[model samples]
Target: MGQGKTSLVQRLYQRAVARYWARSARSAATARLAVLRQQSQKAQDLRRHLNRVIAVSQSRLALPLIGSNSFPRPHGTDWAWRPELWRQPLDRVGIASVANRESLGAEVTLFHDCAVSEVTLRQIRNTREADLAPFGVSMDVLGFDGSFLSLVVDLPDEAVRGLKRSHVIRLDTIVEQESPLEIFVRLNVKHGPNTEQVVHELPVNQEVNTVEFDLAYTKLNEKRVEKAWVDLIFEGPEMNRVILRDATFSRRPRAEF
Candidate 1:
């Protein structure tokens, strides 16, 4: 049953209680006791109905994770085996390191304060990859003391050549901070003789947030978009750790329903 049905039953139960109270005023003691008992029974029936509906709703939502012929495990030592409810896709990508000591990739690097501990990059594989290549990409970075962390991803000309022009670039981030912090997304576009760099600011409170960069508005010289790179800059107080789960580019932009 849906929420509407549950609400209707609750309303009916309240009406029954009211009717019982009204009749008890003039009825004999035995009759009043019977009326109270009936009201209790109706309340119990509503509670049972609610429980059944909730169970059905949860089962429906979990159908995707609960594959055929296997029982779903709530938690496991392997992170991938854990249930989907606790997984945050954006916090799953990139490469993780401690302080500014480790390089994420050939073109990517991380730097952070020693005080801020535990930074990670994780990737949440989309449906296509989950069924075909069941693996996740992640990076964990830890900061000690106060430090600056930067991530640089090199995008070669060949990489962007075939990319759809109407795509949306999305970044998922989780921030753990005692104070407010400023995060930056810098885009550097390099064409043969021309180079354009743009920086976007993302301010994060003590909350998890998702930021989307719309590339459609970016007037890239379609013919000269030879090479590009994105730099994520983090600057803030000590003990501020940020986790980046996923960064994805999709050709489909969200439309209003």
Candidate 2:
């Protein structure tokens, strides 16, 4: 009987040990699963933040370097300029159903005489290898019944400082259009009591369209030049999409005849 009792006690001890080990294993597995869930949640949150950072970085990196003021200039070029709209990003990216005297940026304004508005203006990033400027301006026109449509760009104060009659101002532009178009660049210089103006037709649908205004020809008052601007007039621009990829200015003295 004692031997039997001893055998039974051994069997009971074995079962109790087995039960304890089974419970410990379940607890360990539960703890491991909780740790896995916590790690997965953290990883997901990290991924979300990384994606946002990557998107913004890629967008900015894809564009041409900002604040780039480099362009080809003639020898002896006194002053060269790339407008703000082309050199950097604007506060507003685009506008639809544009109104008269609507301004795109601080420096550019749109003017038209249409009874109903049918124009859209947007700033687009230039990504092509041949584009020199970082940004470009795009215009969409449809069913235009306007007598005149023009985009005016106000020149900086430096453009008028030390003005003289012997200087020749050159306007260079790169334009892409859906069809053949006629465009004109009119340079206006404001003197004391009068404004001197000169108009030159641009050769559109070409690689580079350039026009030069010789101040020597215009009755420009040298001593009283206070401000200057350029008007880009579009003629019969109906049903057309025009993209002005680049617009730049440079000044040089005319060679003595």
Candidate 3:
């Protein structure tokens, strides 16, 4: 028998059993027993019919079973099963650091190299504003040999001047080893030289630190923001590596509370 024929028979048998059960409730006790036996016989016949159909048509079917092995059994029941295609582990390696040379410009590439030696990068979701957030974007150089390391960012003049209110600029740093460090944040506005140039001293021995540059209290003209840059200056000690995990610039509206 074919699959189609077998399915038709099964459906007819089920319908017959249902109809008999519904009518048998009003029948006598002996009639009820006879109806039950007939239903059981119908179920057995259906099973036999399906077996015959399988033997003749050579159709495939799946059956779940128990196993004692570490891996679970495949969802299907086939003799020629290939385990490699469906049951295999996936690689879960992650990237360290990334730099956008195009945006940084060609002239600035010679001064510094963006890398991730002892850090990791990840993508963030469900952020309030932007879709993606950067992780492990900063660098921590040892020995402080480099003379100048600056990041130049181009911005629209309208956005710079529109920032009349105070905002918080955050920089995340991790100190692998101890050394004296000086950090400077300078904002270059449009039609102006350097507006807000503030220098802050880092701690001698600290695990992890977060440096926040508040633009509210500073002498920054938010209405004239055309080109901006951040300069990181390291002073003292000839050997030490600072791991900058991440740096983000976000605006936090002043709270009344």
Candidate 4:
């Protein structure tokens, strides 16, 4: 009987030990799962923090670069200044008016074929937050049935005098767009009854913004030159908001070879 009792006691001890080990294994697995969850959350949080820091740094860095003009010039510069759009407020700024009659401050006119019924143009004052000049042109295009939308700038009569073939006309502009649209910039010279035009395709990148007109190639009648003008035309510009942040005109004589 004692031997049987000893055998039973040994069996009971083995079962208790097995149960204890299984429980310990389950507890260890639970602990490992909890640690993994905590680690994953921490990693995600760290990524979010890093992204925020990077955004803040980039924005602050761009601040100093605003309103800065740096162009390469091998020849002596004749003129460099911002367009009339930024120098002062328009006589009429906030209201949307007929493109034909929209007086965009001095020396500039906004013109579009979209019937007076379907076009909207507003001159918005650029807040200090934009880090831009004093004003920007805003256009909301809807049902644009027109063949072309353009802003015409009439150059002063003085621009034609003392203007030689060796001089180059350069235009600098800043445009902010909501949708991608092609823009054509043209410089028109009217001497007597003949008008000669030079067209340039504005770059696709928003930051891209200068166009150069070399007068040497044109057969311009300097003596008969009576008028000068610029055209900014937008093609396929439906349902878009285009902001002209700033524009400047400059001329420099080409370096003699």
Candidate 5:
């Protein structure tokens, strides 16, 4: 039989079993009815658990399974790094200072109105059982009362020129949350008076996530690019813990026509 045919037969059998159970319970004697009711309740609980398992399975199956050790680049990769899992010793991987248009690191900065007590940033060695990275940056937000909070990374000089109109920049990372909140990633490049930015919405519930920015469609003046940066903006992050498990960037030039 075909796969669909098998499913149809199984569904029919389930329905038949349900009908028989109902009918048998209805015709049972008082004592038998009590025992049957208990058994039925147990069966219902099992069914509920099974349904939950099915739902979880479907959700997991919906996303493509990506390997942890390596990222597959069908078109071939130009540049890639697992930032949060850096092998080299970083100078300052943590910035606990209150963020508000202030510089955080040599290349990283924070912009926010959150008080010092409300936020804490730390660089931690990934020692947890859930961590997939060797190193990570952890941000504990007690209360984010600011209108805007963003973590900015100034692109290196090489990126300002090496990034071409045909190149695609991809951001891959693992994010953990204390609660549900929407986060936005913005890729910025400044040509002159205008700063071109492309936003990517990151859904927080997924285990593995990636976002790409194609420069071909952007109005960026690649020749006149004076500066470049990337912004990781958090929205409604009050009372939340956000951990960057692993973040990497890969730039791939478009295939030749």
Candidate 6:
């Protein structure tokens, strides 16, 4: 049968069952034995199917709404974005014992120098009212012996379109760590054969987690800009559980002096 017809039948069946229960509660004695027998038989036949539907419904409905791309952006912002991991569900929900050069989603990748990997990366649904993104990423680090660990997010073509040295790229994120840690944000702009990198120490301990990169400071060749990406470097992240509740990027022109 067609999906629409099947859904209609299910709704009608639910209405009839609801009415039956309401009447049964009022006067069970009024129910004839023949009708009761038929009702029992029908309910027994439908119980397994109904239970399956209920289970699937609960699982899907409990997740945050999908395809939510809206987020706060700065004034005069030409571009704003929340990475794919925070905007949609991944085919693979998580990774255990993540190795070097491993990736969670299409845009995010984990790179480390540890020999024996002891890290896990997972995508989680954000259900709190204060959460701006529909999804988040969680990382658990234990006994890490890596000299460097960072998550890289590749920006789409739109981020590099019409790029110029006059623009100031901004990074805003909400991170919760088990202990004190310093995180740094690096903006990489590939222009021609050379890549320009701008690094800023993310003030994660402050009330607001934000950092900006002024391209004017970097020797970026705007005319030859090809691609851009961001790196989130975690310093001394051993034995820590870090949840990146939200990460967003925005670009705006710097005000003239």
Best by lDDT: 2
- Model 4 off-target regions past 4 Å? 1-75, 128-132
lDDT digits (tens) for residues 1-257 of candidate 6: 75556577788998998998777657656778898787668777878888999987764665456767777889999999989999898999899999998989899999999999999999998877677778899999998988999999999998999989999999888898888799988999999999999999877566358889999888888789999999999999999998998888999998899
Top TM-score hit:
6
Between candidates 3 and 6, which one is better according to TM-score? Answer: 6
lDDT of 5 at 128: 54
Identify the runs in model 5 with alpha carbons over 4 angstroms from their true place: 1-74, 82-97, 115-117, 128-132
lDDT of each: 0.50, 0.88, 0.40, 0.72, 0.70, 0.88
Report the lDDT tens digits of candidate 5 across residue range 1-257.
65545577788999998897787666656547677788778778978988999987763443222233444553667766444223223566555646576553466577787555476776655555554455566778876667888877776666666667888888877888888889899998888888888999998787568899888889877678887778889998888888876666677887778
Off by more than 4 A, model 3: 1-161, 178-194
lDDT of 1 by residue, 164-240 (tens): 34544444344445446677877766766776566777765634444555555666666666776677786753444
Candidates 1 and 4, the one with greater lDDT? 4
Estimate, for each residue in 76-126, the C-alpha lDDT of model 2 and write its tens digit. Answer: 898999999988899998999999999998999999999998999999988
Residue-level lDDT for 239 in candidate 3: 48
Preferred candidate (TM-score higher): 1 or 4: 4
Model 6 spans with C-alpha error above 4 angstroms: 1-16, 19-64
lDDT of 3 by residue, 171-242 (tens): 434333445555444444342565555445556566455555566677766655555444544444234444
| lDDT of candidate 1 at residue 30, scale 0 to 100 | 58
Query: What's model 4's lDDT at 185?
Result: 94
**What's the lDDT of the predicted structure labeled candidate 2?**
0.88
Worst 10 residues of 3 by lDDT: 77-86
Candidate 4 lDDT tens digits, 1-257: 65446677788998996786566556655667776577557657866988999976664454324344433433577766555555555677654545565666777777876665366667666554544455567777766777878878777665666777787888877888888899999999887888878899998757548899998888888778887888999898878878787767777888787
lDDT of 6 at 252: 95
- 65 Cα displacement, candidate 1 (Å): 10
